[model samples]
Target: MRHEHEPKQRKHTVRNVILTVILVLLVSVGAYAARKYYNIKHAVDNTYQSAGIKKNRNANAVIQAKSPISILIMGTDTGALGRSYKGRTDTMMLITLNPKKDKTTITSIPRDTGVTIPGYESESPSKINAAYAFGSSGTAIKTVQEMLNVPIDFYAVMNMGGMEKVVNAVGGVTITPTLSFSYDGYTFTKGQSAKMNGKKALAYSRMRYSDPDGDYGRQTRQREVIMAIMSKAGSISSLLNKDFLDSVSSQMKTDLTFSDLSAIAQNYLGARKSVSQTHLQGTGQTVNGQSMELMAKSELQRVTNLNRKNLGLDHATTGNIALSVSDASSSSDSSVQSANVNAGN
Candidate 1:
């Protein structure tokens, strides 16, 4: 009877050990899965093609290398319900990332600002936003380059739906109202801190009719949302979530490569924190029976000076190139004049 009892006790001990080992293995697997999920979640595909813009092969020659890279952040009204890819960019901002100074300058160009397209000649003075519809991203880049007299290094295009998804992914962003205004069935009170989700944030940035500053005020709100999004994105929680990355990538298109993103993530993450906002000073005028924002030559020169100085580019005079206009006979520039400047995070 004693021998039989001993055998049973040994058997029970053995069973306990086996169960413990299995539990440990399961825990290890879970940890690994979590790590992998985080890595992949923050990892985004490089969608930027370096074709039209000037390429700097020596961009990453050394640590703390000061390379001035310009990116076009485009927000399109495409991919929304009942919308298609043929939509033009509704918001565009030129972001100059200066890694050396750990500083960034964002220049907001009102979409209604008239500009000449580089390759086209039929239109002498056309709305700035028309460049995207006429020639896609490439043409838009060229048009901006001509308009601003600056080099564009990359382009990131985000659909309207993607903007909402990004806002939702970060939970939400807080925006301070500049003035009390209502449009698109939404009302924003002055001097209030509004917690905005994707839809409401979209409405917040899109409402321009009731704004006292008009497009400029709307653009300021857009920049506010952008800065809010960037702040949320920089958090460790966002960097570790794979679901958020997949959502953002699916909703947006870009020319930034994966390696470029990683380098930016590792090297220029500080620059995002130190950003200065810029707006082109312009006035509204009726051109060809349509209201347009006309940027004065002095205003353009000021933006060019600011962008060039921020990027550490060769300090050249802003009036070297002739302004080229896009062909307006094919498409009305008024349809494309909806571009506004917002945040680029």
Candidate 2:
């Protein structure tokens, strides 16, 4: 039941922080749920989605053998938050978990980064996020693997909207902003700590234009809230909410089985250490008329090397990757019709 004092926010309109929230909270919370295994298992089971791609390394074997592995965490702004159509992914993070070393890395891939969606239109570069729309998780995984030259062993996709409910379910989150700004009817000042409910948290994270670093600054605030929620979500009362569990499960689809989560809780507790994040930078260009972010080959190679090192794979330089356009004058953007890229970088 919602608090009568709380004002109602938009019905299905939260952002993608829930992707990381669900990915971690589900596993760590379950680790403490020895008394509620069946219930937790049932909820996780409701989120089963098979990737069906042949892996270079088997996920189960790697986990059972206590080896390192990588996962792609994706969140689509679709099927909820008033987005009824099949939507593209706005949030994509390449995650590597090393249980042997107690370290984890999250590399953010911009939604508008230009890449060829393998099976979709195989002709030219489209934003990396469109890979999900062209084909679901499978194509997205294939595109990321081909471009970055990394093996994705597991993945999870969720409607970004559940974040609001998640925040409220944890009795709301507290945050301190580094800058003061107003967006969507809420305001916060730099260096001031205040408790934020779901709606305010969403507004706080979604404001990028006012930030000095734009989207990267937005990501930092998102991380702050994610850490806040992760810290608060460990309580039994928070995870045992039947209504929250049902709603979250219905919105998520993942290749991780309940057993996989259980194994993670058992063998990979070390991965719960402080997360290190890297952002793959991209420059905007008119790609076939649409504004797309293009990453340089050197940057891709840098990201690839880190992911490979974390996964214990032999380092190999990335090739066949999309390179950024340098000559801006060559773009016939005014002449060519742009592709629909409603989601911005």
Question: lDDT (CA) for every model shown?
Answer: 0.59, 0.70
Q: Write the per-residue lDDT of candidate 2 for residues 261-287, one digit (tens) a residue.
A: 777767775665535566788787776
Question: For candidate 1, which ten residues in a row score worst on lDDT?
Answer: 18-27
Q: Model 1, range 1-345, lDDT digits (tens) per residue?
A: 011123433333322221111111111222335555434424344233443544333333422353667777776765642244346666787877777787767676777776656665454355666666666678888777777778777776666556677789889988888788776677889899989999888888777677777776666566566667766765445544666655556666566655455556556545644556666666666554445566656667888888888778767556422222222224354332332111100
Could you tell me the TM-score of candidate 2? 0.83
Model 1 CA deviation exceeding 4 Å by range: 1-34, 37-43, 46-66, 80-85, 172-176, 191-195, 227-234, 272-274, 319-345
Q: Model 2: clashing residue pairs?
A: 12-81
Number of residue pairs clashing in candidate 2, backbone atoms closer than 3 angstroms, sequence gap of 3 or more or interchain:
1
